[model samples]
Target: MTSMNHNQRRGRVVIGVDTHKHIHVAVALDDFGGVLGKEKFTADTAGYGQLIDWSMTHGHLLTFAIEGTGSYGAGLTAAVRRRDIGVVEVMRTDRRDRRLRGKSDFLDAENAARAVLAGHADAVPKTADGLVEMIRTIKVAKDVAVKARTSAMISLKAVLVNAPAPLREQLQPLSKMALIHRCAGLRPGSMTTVEAATKHTLRSIARRWEQLNDEITAHEKMLAELTTTLAPQLCAAFGVGADTAAEMLIVAGDNPERVRSEPAWARLCGVAPIPASSGMTTRHRLNRGGHRQANAALYRTVIVRMQHHEPTKSYVARRTAEGKTKAEIIRCLKRLLAREIWSLMRPLRINPQTVESAA
Candidate 1:
């Protein structure tokens, strides 16, 4: 089975990897997207070695594109890169779009491989041993914490809704520090003992929410450390704190060279607008393409910039006077911020202000 999979006659091979948590499937395709060989294996050392060996025996593994490199895709990409194997991280096919045709792991893997071979898929490979993956993991943690915090808030609000006005007043400050204290005794006076017992269950939920707050803070500190160490250069600027810098740097991936243009970064963040034209009209709107997570991080930075500092305030006011709406102005500012970010992250040339001075 391994030999059949390892056949050198697989033609010029472009590999597509369908990534999941426990297992990964890789298919080698010829130039015409014909499947030369396909194998399903666990995403462990033995599995990685088998896949690499298969590719090396065939033509050089020209490009390996995997979907969602930041999630389940991380382990596979890291494994491949460790073997000096080149990887192309493809975006996942939209489930709705995929369903329009059909849905299966086989189809997903084929679409990914075909995307790479057809020149339709271009993924920015991470550099410095996939540090972007590590930073991206922190983002996952941050998001989890956010959800936990939100759940806690929702529970608090539920309590407020059910409690009498007096009880609400007691808990209102908790809206501010509500998640800080334990919710062991929270109960509505109107409820019977049974109802009270169930209501108190919400207190347990609130306690869990408090734990999430601590976790969120801890993950944020770890994210800060990533910037402080791997990308201290990114954090050197005003308004670009550890979280902002780390998010930017992570999506930038250590391989800044893979992103050839500032517009590429902007597009990846979905902050750059697309030009839509009719027979006689030409207008640009917010880019509907690229990674939404990266776009969101940049959007948050824009909000932070507008509210936090002088230059950002002046820029917003100036753009507003020039007749741009709030949405239009934000889009413009995000692009500008993208350019500044690209300059600071000049992959080929290190600015003295970045890693050097910090070092």
Candidate 2:
């Protein structure tokens, strides 16, 4: 039988990483929170291997505390976990701490390790290697297309407002779609005159809008298909559509098990009620923090249920009869929806260990 090495015999160690575009700063610490070593490595596969090997020299690497796990640190986090090491998502160092202790990449990396050791940062980073990632990418494209289309429409209208009287008269009375079709069909033979210039610009903007519409449609179709495939139960749930399901999935991340619980999921979506108690007054208020997009998805789900679901309508009516305000009712509905969505998403959960192994 092979004998255990010194580093291997050591109980456990933690590594903290401060990641950047081209480089990463790492700090290693023992179980008792003593610094082992610090090093800088290139932000690449080779560098990841070197960093892991170096950390293992100090002790058994039990976990990594990483900052910006969704952005700059994502690659490093993925790389480390691929070796079956645990990774915790660490928030950036508090500004107050930076002011008092000063700031440097090495210091930040050390702080990350200390935070994890102190039990201050315990959340697992998302595994962005699955269908949820694909949906997020598609949603981003769709968002840009929608924004561009709106801008094109606004510009088209603004130009018409100042266009030549004859051209304005010719286009102003048309409906929005009709105006776009007409402008796109315009034959601007000459750009030498102001009227011709107006026609040319309008035609360009209208055509761009049409193209964006097509792009958005394609993205939506793709999103619907992907969301359904990823979470059919979520997609089939009352008041949950492709867009809402996609947003929820993105917020929960590719590995839903990292969410911990339904309340944690609600907090992530900004639907968790925050306690606002005073000496003689005990009350909870709406949470304004968390992912706004996810909150909006929950709101949209509530709206759909309010409008069409019989049981939801009854609940609303009963709440109103008991003197609850519409906003309060909506808040309650959102919390309920959050719980429902979390339950549905749980079945699709991927074990965090599986994520690390598959990384």
Candidate 3:
């Protein structure tokens, strides 16, 4: 009897893709994890179509394991999903595994398929085609502008410290904002002396700071408007402002359903308690692995509530009386806040206006 080919025996296929800026390498494996075909395609519309068609010929397209779904693979993921094909985000192969198996584009592509077949790569890639993406873009711009402004201020201060006596004496006592304003208004006309040159440099830096401040303000305003429109209830939640709300929204992505459950969300925020049990030392420890920005947002919310919300203040007092350290109390509070935020975020994925209408 003739031996059946692997594709014929398995019938179903999985495609693994290693994406890059200009090209994507793909490998197709049968249900039994046998490589059927491997190909390289350009990272564009035509290439995506060819890749899909190429994989389909091996057998039925089961799912796609793609690296960098949020970065280089984003467009391809969207394209595949639009055609109703399943896609999962695959992180880079472990260094140890790479070292053992040896490395090549085909090897990485095959690894991605093996990961999917073995259930190692099961994360649903984010559908970054929504208002949250817009918020992320604006936030990134604002963050860069703020950093530049801060650097400019630091350099301006450094110059001021070494400035000529006449200029230093004039500006040394001014507060930060006042100093920027004063330097921006300096009328240093000629580079006749060291003091004049110093004044000119300070003025330029101050003007740049002013421009960045305006840019940040504009971005904040856009964030406020978008957050209010997307999830008014989240924005209105006690102690949650536009910046904090926006950060959390970005973490949850446009389709929060992929987050799975509240516990998962808590883990994503790094507020979940991790089991640290050993032989007879059963306990939990604070998790330190999730999105740090989301953790900071939760921390800020807890602080605001502790200061102004009566029930939270009473809870704090009770915890303190129960011998909990301040840090421990904050950790507990962060976990609780993460659960509450998760509850609020779930409805957002389905209908962002649900909370607003209820209110």
Candidate 4:
């Protein structure tokens, strides 16, 4: 990979980055879309620094436009933010079809840079390796534990379905303890040929599941510690539980400043609908934009809150009486919830003198 240095102090240049797991391709363009340099670099610290040195040596690097900020772009974004470099996230290939033709590492990088110059693709990027990553790791581990517990219960019930009536009755109330003890004592050689084989496999699974639960509890403790040290604003909000708050913070990329407005946040979560107006019918349909996983987090949240939150529940009931379907009502709730979250969260942004204030 050739390292570039911007020896010429040209006007603002646009950088397009095509990212992969270990390598990233970047292309630089002068103010007029003239290709200045293109090269491959390792995604690590040394590589990005060389890219930076190249940019500065040639001229001022205006910004980086990259496709898909949530995945391969994540490492790159984290890398850039650590350097305080300006990077913009471009919508994926679906944003335009023409650019999709003749795609390659070099071409994709060029398109990313061109998109910056053309002003067609861009977003204020959030950090990749900040509190967001910490939150996500904790949440995933907890989810694994919860799933394991659920699976254990399900498997126990399945075993009961075929169990002898007297045995089932004896184990009914003592199910948890009985299952745990039996599973703990089970080994490959403990039973007859067939019985031992089945018991050994199932018991191994149970033991592994129990171990996973222990890991989950440890993660929970870590999560509790981080809740106070970081993401305090999210933790302080009503209806935002630990896992939910952690997910939302990660989705927002830890820096609420780039989230901008309620609509922006909603759109980022794929909850806000795109505007579609026909001659006679003008209504907003759901938008599948931005992060679907984050949108699902909000969806799960509102459902839990709708059962207990009087104001939000009443709002849904009122809208329901107006003949809105359950799905429609849920959609409306998602948007409103996005707005509320944005309002509660905007004050927590790390930036100062921010523009484009939204209600």
lDDT per residue for candidate 4 within 87-177, as digits (tens), equals 8887655435545576578877887887778888667766555656666777877887888877876775676555556545644566675
lDDT of 3 at 179: 100
Worst 10 residues of 1 by lDDT: 348-357
Best prediction by lDDT? 2
Give candidate 4's error at residue 308 in angstroms: 2.3
Work out the TM-score per prediction.
0.77, 0.93, 0.93, 0.80
Candidate 2 steric clashes: 0
Q: Model 1 TM-score?
A: 0.77
Q: What is the lDDT of candidate 1?
A: 0.73
Stretches of model 3 off by over 4 angstroms after superposition: 1-10, 352-359
* lDDT by residue (tens digit), candidate 1, 1-359: 57657554455677888887788887778888777778787877787777777766657646788887866777677777887767887877878868798977767888898888878787666654545556777878898789878977787677656765655566566645643353545653666765465457657777777788889889889888767676665678666777778778767765667776778778877777788888899887677888776677778888888898799899889988899899888888788877887777774334212333344
Pairs of colliding residues, candidate 3: none
* Candidate scoring better on lDDT of 1 and 3: 3
- Identify the superior model by TM-score, candidate 1 or candidate 2: 2
Q: Model 2, range 176-293, lDDT digits (tens) per residue?
A: 9999999999988867899999999999999999999999999999999988877888999998888999999889888888888888888999999999999999999889999999
